[model samples]
Target chain A: AQRVTQPEKLLSVFKGAPVELKCNYSYSGSPELFWYVQYSRQRLQLLLRHISRESIKGFTADLNKGETSFHLKKPFAQEEDSAMYYCALSGINTGFQKLVFGTGTRLLVSP
Target chain B: EAGVAQSPRYKIIEKRQSVAFWCNPISGHATLYWYQQILGQGPKLLIQFQNNGVVDDSQLPKDRFSAERLKGVDSTLKIQPAKLEDSAVYLCASSRTDGLENEQYFGPGTRLTVT
Candidate 1:
């Protein structure tokens, strides 16, 4: 079975500091990875995908197949970036794009 | 252009009661998904539909949970004889059927509290 693991349940960082939300996956075949963000009172939205290979809102994630990881990173954390982060995987299943998600990590950026 | 829409933002029901949630996906979207998000946990995919047809429902609890997306537009998820463990936020999301590049858009979830 495919699974996404976000080791940190809560990560607190000071504003202007760096942040890295660790995400690891367990899958035998190639996987499509993504990072979803849910802010307080806001619906969950896509932050970025591994295939896009582009940064959104100053956040970027690199797919490391060897490590089976797709860690989301930001050089300078901002208070507005505080939100619930979820690591999701797709393409593991044959039929539809059923997303497998991790338990999620809450990012808290202190000002 | 409009985002997904979900009704009954909050619901409180006793165990064994029945409840249903409605979801209207974005216009022109061909794929729809339903997820269950427990407090302090990420959302889990309960079911997925493509154009009014079930694509994946392996995770959905068929005995107690049921869902349908008729006409490939709106969908409903029902839980019969709900259990205390079923207390969670139900989320509805949609995306185009153009394959992998399309990302899902979510709606404000309906929080179900089973007491």
Candidate 2:
């Protein structure tokens, strides 16, 4: 049973403070990981993926296979960076591949 | 190129009524997906299609939910006798079927409210 877990339902941080949103997964085989974000009234968009190893919007995530985590982090949070973030895993199950997503975490950066 | 398109932006219906939503994927995309996103939750994949053929539909509630992509161009998802718990935003996404990497592009979801 492959599953994604986003422990925090909501996280608040002051502007310019460092931010970290936790994410973990339970899977046996190698998994492809992704981060998606949805801002107010905007369509959901891809933020970044582990394979790309690229930072987007001043955020970066490292895949820690030993701990089964891919936590998203940012050095300095901005008010405009507040949004809902989801962690997803792509894996094979019963001869088919599917992307399973976590419940999601809402980040509120207060100025 | 235009992004995925879905309509109507919002829909309200009473329980036991039937409703349908439409999606038009990006030009030349070979894979399309439908997802359900409840408030405060991430989007859940209900179905996936490669061209006009169904690739995965294990999570779709067949009794009440049905979808079709007739010519591999446009798609539609229908719910007959909708339930109150069925209220959620329906999202459409598309990606190239080359199989190297699946980076899906999503559309503005259709918000469904079943009372």
lDDT (tens digit, per residue) of candidate 1 on B59-101: 9999999999888899999999899999999999999973677
Q: Which regions of candidate 1 deviate over 4 angstroms?
A: A92-95
TM-scores, one per candidate? 0.97, 0.96
| Candidate 1 chain A lowest-lDDT run of ten | A90-99
lDDT by residue for model 2 (A1-111), tens: 779999999999999999999999999988888999999988888899998999999999999999999999999999999999999988744344478899999999999
Query: What DockQ, between 0 and 1, does each candidate earn?
Result: 0.68, 0.61
Computed on alpha carbons, the lDDT of every model, listed in order, comes to 0.93, 0.92
Model 2's CAPRI class is medium
Q: Which candidate has the highest TM-score of all? A: 1
Q: In candidate 2, what are the lDDT values of residues B1-115, reduced to their tens digit?
A: 9999999999999999999999999999988999999987888999999999999898999999999999998999999989999999999999887253767999999999999
**Per-prediction CA RMSD (Å):** 1.1, 1.5
